[model samples]
Target: MARASTHPRSCGLKHRGFGRRFALLLMPLLVVGCAWGSSSETRTGDRAVPDPDASENVTFYPTYGYLEDDEWVVPVRYWVWEDRGLVSRVVTRVASSMAGLEPQQVETFRHRLRPFSGDSEWRQRVTFVFEDDPLGQEYQVLDERGRAPRTDRNGVVEGKVRIPAQRAEELLAAQGSQGGWLRWEAVSRDHSGTGQAILVPSEGTSVISDIDDTIRITEIPAGWSVAVRNTFFDEFREAPGMPELYQEWDGEGDVLFHYVSGTPWQMYESLSEFLFHEETGYPEGTMHFRTVRKNLVSISTWRDLRSLVSAGAETADRKYEVIAGMMEDFPDRTFRLVGDTGEGDPEIYRSLARRFPGQVEEIVIRDITDDRTLRPERLEGMTVIPAETIERATGPDAIVADLRWQPQSVRVLW
Candidate 1:
């Protein structure tokens, strides 16, 4: 078993002295989701759960850390933020709920960002920004014996304990206890947030999927209005049959999922609500967002949607870097890159395929735009397929089963 793990102080705390370096001694892992219990809703303003926010509000974007002295040095990345214009009309609402605004206020905010006047969808998405995650805020690490009150989650952390490398692996080996993870439970007299680290398994198939257009029905290339309509409005439509297809892949042997997108860290909870919802039910995986904007004053106008396509090579570069790092981190594990021509996913995969020829296995690019024409030369290693064709896939291995898809007929992402 690994020793008690410690999470170093979170970012944006450079100035303080006395309460300088707090470390969390994470308890043995718990499977994320459905451990909701308020120590009883201590009300303040609209919020219920005291000053503490649950996983529904506080999002964790955990990545595996390198092994140090035989134990895995796991870094748990978490954030706490006020809804700003986010959350619900009533504090009773959580996750995807955004603050209600009148017509004038919403339009005023949208007009500052886009020349176009706002619509209902525009207003909904426009106000979807987090009140900056407080800088210089202090977070204390929980003791080894700290246990958050649990409702129904079995392994929902009764006592905290350090994880040794061997112990973590053993947990992964257990039949029903399988899946790569190291969960952290937080217990504050005021707030509650429990996050888990996605451990990089020794040998497993990893799928690095894209969010926009590829999995979610986000017509980013369809213009700004379409993108906004899709981002915040509705519970989010799946890209045809991606949710079912992804679940199939999840059941295919030992598969781990990762979503790399231009979506900012602020939208983590909202996105999580869509992806992890039992209705949509995409595999539980680590999400990596592009920008981490502190304040939403400038962005409150819903301008960030333009980054979907207009972000240029900067978008491709960031995705390439993320995918490359993943392949490098787990050389033995093969990866299937699934993306759409909606974003520069094909080009990003092309770059990585060349760099890590051995690690990157199949490149699947989905095309749904009206103008379906991608240069075959640019997508040298990718297999362009229609959504219907992929939906026909039986399992992960069958993803490229019908590679009759031609790149020459794919949409070219800006």
Candidate 2:
């Protein structure tokens, strides 16, 4: 009886050890299953949550173009945001950057991540009303329907509207000695929001001015840190006497001021605000901006990373393309190219002057860098004046004297 009991006890101990081993092996799988379940639930809940701060505020970005026979076409684009709040936007931007998703993927994810943020097709009908004189009389809003915003590769929707133009010569003649601007306002029928556009005279000397380092302090040649700080964190600071120089150049408001920059179009709102608040006396003609890549991190950083890598060669090429297009668009009007030495502006301007012989009147290079390599060489017919000489030149009288076309009498502000 004692031997039989011992055998049964031994078998029971063996069975207990096997059960412990099995439980140890199954424990990891159970933990993994629980983790996966929790994650799935969290994702589902996130998909169900609605965006509370979505708004219908619209933004406009106007481009310059001239129509045939004294008619002008101001091509304007608008953008509608799902959420304008800073924190929500930051979160969205981070998610967008990390995912590196395509436009369609982004649209799909918008519902899963932020259901109330709306899709890329969310477009509102808007109407533009011209308030100022001469312009109101000359041009009318031919098409009242605002375009449905289409998403670009970067998931940015650009809605377009062209403000029609007619009888521009008559409008210009009416202004006479008193120079003024034609203003128009755009308002959405569905949303309580508005945007403005200013039209300048297309005739006379067209001044193509560079924005970074030339007009605003962007320290491009200094280094990346300074450039990034100035662009994102620091306040807008204009170059000394640049506003005065621009005012003098626009004597009698005949000169058309077109701001051309290598800065991406994303910074348009901030730059426009800076221009408006600074009171630069610069007549808003047409704003030309660079094409941006479809990357949220690069966009959020204001393209500072790319800027550091670029050696100004690519920027010069872009500037040339934009300027050359302008020259082709307005063949009759003479151009005055204004830029700084931080980039290849001097070299680029010189090449442009050579390419368009009689069309390019002058090349004004602001010597931000004391580099002697950019010394002005006679570029046949066109005058290349340094900014230092411009400051001492004593207003329009002295400045015009340096130009090829010296009028008998010039407007003197100083």
Candidate 3:
């Protein structure tokens, strides 16, 4: 993924249209605002142990590493924040329900400002992002191998360490390929954190899958309110047979996974936990989530949230850029594109298939919309599997091109 703006307070979008549509929706909730400020930081602390008394905490983002020249470049990203408790007991009540209206283009916009999302889980999630003060803290890797990196204005630290390819291979080999964490010591706080790292080799089979309706059911087709309720209020429900199916592919031990989603980074912890849960059984792949910066303490934060609903924020471009970057980075590796018909996955994947032929081996689109008459041209070089019947596949892996599942002039009946 491309690096975000270097400036800390740089709110990326300044579109006027962002606020007009969602003005009434979040106006009442925006009536109440909070204040937050970061204190001067200090780096004096013991590196060996974590202190429960430490005021600041570090949250590591799970990511992947790549091989460049003779070294392995692994990204060490983290969020530094003070764990303030819930900001307020104020419930996020919907101003009005969107029962029949067509859902907006982006899921994040539709996922915002829910009325029934007053539960502790939803509140805590919001508080973590909006309430906490993200300090521009500094830290060094525990091994003292690379330069110590500091968190940006958003309290996020994006840095990398370069290890000799041979040594990196040794560590990865011992850590079980994707089963590894990098230890770090805080220079300013009396605490430490571990960042999960998945190492994708120079060339291999990688599965690029979508989240939302593709894996986790977000009910995008049910309209705006339901999608938001499902996101903020209800427990995430996994798509039928996907977790089991992904687990089967992950068991192969040679495949790499990349979960590309339009969901905001705020839902990362909850979504990641669900994916790694004992029942879910999905492979821990590199995550590609869109970032939407928000500060609940200000009325202006609503404008940032509104970007999710704005026309400019349609995720087709974001998904394309992310997936295309991956294909470019690993030119020799083959990729399998997986998504749902709930949105624009078919068209996006079709574009990728055309742009990078042979590199993308298969395109499997889960049919969330029950369109009996399929347009073969739209889904050219793809398999349209009904979302429900995808589980009936007692055979073939996710990328295994089955002749029976090939797309026809009408549709592929799985």
lDDT against the true structure, per candidate, is 0.48, 0.50, 0.54
Better of 2 and 3 by lDDT: 3
Inter-residue clash pairs, candidate 2:
none
Q: Which stretches of candidate 3 lie over 4 Å from their true place?
A: 1-54, 86-88, 91-149, 173-188, 295-303, 310-314, 372-376, 388-414
Question: Considering summed lDDT, which 10 consecutive residues are worst modelled in model 1?
Answer: 23-32
What digit string (tens of lDDT, one per residue) describes model 3 on residues 108-185? 223443211211111111111101113322324322444454444445545566667776555545544434433333
Model 3 score (lDDT): 0.54
TM-score of each: 0.58, 0.59, 0.67
Residues 62-136, model 2: lDDT tens digits:
555466554465555554433322222333454345434345433433333231122222334445554434445
Clashing pairs in 1: 1-164, 2-163, 2-164, 4-162, 27-161, 52-190, 52-191, 87-97, 373-410
* Cα lDDT tens digits for candidate 1, 172-198: 454223355655444433234556656
TM-score: model 1 vs. ground truth: 0.58
Best by lDDT: 3
